[model samples]
Target: MKIACVLLLLLNLQQVRTDLQYDSCGYWTYSKGFGLPEFTERIVLNDVTVYYHDSSLRSKMPCPDWINTTAGKEEWSSIHAWSVHSRYVSALGFQSATKQFNLTGSLSDQNIYQASGCCSLYPDGTYRAFVTHAFNGKDFLSLDFKRKTFVAAVPQAVLYKTLRERDSATIEEIVAYYRTRCLDRLNILKQAPGVLIRKVPEVRIIEQQKVGSITVTCHVTGFYPPVVQMVWLGPDLQPVDEGVTDVLPNEDGTYQTRKSVIVPEEDVGEHTYSCVVLHSSVPDNITRVWGGGKAGGMAVWISLVCIWLLAAGIGLVVWWYRTRDAVI
Candidate 1:
């Protein structure tokens, strides 16, 4: 049972998604297996990384791009010292955790542990800080400053949280760092001039012909800040049930997402089906329609699903920003 718990921990260990409102946040993640622990850190201002450091580098500070560096030399020196101490603390905690659970599995078991923290400053002059832990690859516990307590994400965390809450002094120290020290760090990092860039998404409607019904997918791509909403609306703009895909990051720092819905083939021309997208980068809502309207006609790149439909002997039609291809 102990072995299975740690194995599950490793399997679930990945970065937790951030739900912060603003982008003045500093993210820290420390992970270790059985070697010299690896420390990775990045500080972002307006979604731009102003500072980055990792254990792989011998130097403490990130190299300046021959321009004004993020922070002063003295600051980097201080950060380096702090990060070094932090790495050991995290590693030691890993040791203590294993002992607490009586995990005496073979060293070949290959274990992993991660501790992450985020401190963000909202535009309304409000700020929030949170720290979470994961073993193997699953969330273990979280700190709730409002309740002044630890919130266990999983049942395995209940014992850990109960034990941790007994130490109020350490809890207070954690709160102070997030509320005061962390926010002050963010203020200094945001002083530099920033470029707030935006990119509007290119929306496409991809249709797949099935035996009795057609699967239509709305693909929204090339958007920034990873914020957008897509919905399939039927006639009269009534919301239609749809299956949504995960929002994935692109290599260019933009984002792509998809929402798909299946409709009867006979109903194609009987009712209007449109995909509506709302995003910050877009001034007005962008709508792409199919059936009972002019299908958007443009020389856009064909989607893979359309290609698959063509090869499968079924028919396909693609619509764009204004224009249509008819189902065969």
Candidate 2:
């Protein structure tokens, strides 16, 4: 009887261990063999969802006052550095999010980069997002976790309500509005077959420093089939004579273009500069400017020349008045 009791106790203990193991391993079983980290943060905005994965799970928590916290600062700094060092991550995230959310009306090879964290307000009070991972190259589909459901925040819920509305406008309507309001009317004249304006080009100012003169270098990309004319524009809407160069083609067939602008010491603070591309598509002209700065060199020079001409004219007027009095 003592031996039988001992056997029964051992059997019960083994069953408890098996149950615990099954519970813990349940989450891992659905992972599909992908090696994603244990900690994950999923953010859903409107019809779009973004998942951020971190091996340390630091990014999984709510970032209340994230801008003021050390982790926030570190993330910000790392993003800035990443923007310079490995911008491919940024590019991939943007492309993936837009496609995943079905934001673009037509399925084309163009990649759209949402600088505002994958969330943007639509005309019909709806919000759209392009979700991505916070880590260097992580993405939503790349997640190896088995959990199918995630918690939704208040803002995310609001976005969901907006997207779920049936009366919301379609992407075609939005594109039509954009075409009429933003694009140049003259572009209609240039439209033809095989002259597609694939994707709108984007310009990102990577580095700006004043080594005697203000030297500005920018990263430009996101156009398909390339453009015949890509130039830098000044604040006055005139082209600058900056040397433009094209970077090597990425494996995905998208090209990275760049242009450098050198401003004289005196005119560095005078005008703003922008990267402009002229494509053969619907929006024939696309421009992207840096966050803040005065107009470019062309604008400054033209303004200065106009001022000098005005001053000379004023001097001539005074001389004419004095000469008239002498003749009298």
Candidate 3:
């Protein structure tokens, strides 16, 4: 007899477990009614077996065969109904329930009668149940599932208060959750009202003329708010201690700047000079060139001109002497 009782108890537990087999895959779709995008649900069965819902389907209903027994079927039905109710409550801010009855017996007018209620079960194990009247009106009942008791209506004020409190607690948690998800997106928008920093400037060496000493003048333009420093870059691409001028802003909200560097006569003959513009925001240097100045082309041109004039004068004198001799 003792062995038989133990066997029966084991069978009962197994039956209960079979009845509670639920595919949370079906419950995942309830979020659509709540205005949330579809997502997969992680479901654990018998406190050990686990499965996940496929995210493709919009509306999914748990199959009756998925539950192992009639009790499991009943439990799943109740759970699904509760889930739908919770979704409605969360989305619409309210929910309603009604008792359904069906007549089957010949002697009795109402043979099948079932009490139905919709409720949201919180993560804390508390629940808010909405029970309806025979006419299916706005009657409700709130229950704490943890304590297994009932309460009055869940007023809008109370619901909003609970939502605010829960949202505050969840805000940081949600941010942390998204931080781990590489699939999520971060939107960086430029929303500054007025212009902070504008166009980048251009630098150019306009002229390099020899006036006793080589004077290199560089022209810079095309920057809003102007640049701070414009200097001469040496052949080695380093800043020289040449004199630089302050940037002057133009009338059209741009800038025009000039700087002159005095070059040594020896280094002046044939060397490349760069005008480098420095700005606060940009890292790399902006530069422009003076002349391709090499081998003193200007001095060479002056010497060639003087030689040509002297040769022409000598040729003329030689022609005059030859003609006079011929006449004599």
Cα TM-score per model:
0.63, 0.28, 0.29
lDDT of 1 at 23: 53
Candidate 2 collision pairs = 271-294, 271-295, 272-294, 272-295
Give the runs in model 2 whose Cα sits over 4 Å from its true position: 1-197, 235-238, 290-328
Per-candidate Cα RMSD to the true structure, in Å, reads 14.0, 29.9, 36.7
* Candidate 3, residue 90: lDDT: 34
* Tens digits of per-residue lDDT for model 2, 1-328: 5434423322332221111100000001011113543222232222112223333443333323424546444543433333331233334444445544565554433333322222232212222222222211232322111221211222223233233233234333323322332122112212222322244456677646676776776666765444335555554544566654755564555556777877666766666665544433322234455424655556555544533343344435544544454310
| lDDT over C-alpha atoms for residue 213 of model 2 | 76
Q: Write the per-residue lDDT of candidate 1 for residues 1-328, one digit (tens) a residue.
A: 5434322322221111112334554445555555633666666765777777777887766534433444444445555666765566456545555655566756525556567667754322446667888766777777888677989876766776777788788788778777777765665555544524456789998988899998888999997667666666665445676655689988877889999888887776666676766565543456677763333332111222222233222111111211232111
Position 32, candidate 3: lDDT: 28
User: What's the lDDT of the predicted structure labeled candidate 3?
Assistant: 0.39
Give me the displacement of residue 44 in model 1, in angstroms: 5.1
Residue 315 lDDT in model 3? Answer: 36
TM-score of model 3 vs. true structure:
0.29
Sum up the clashes in candidate 3: 1
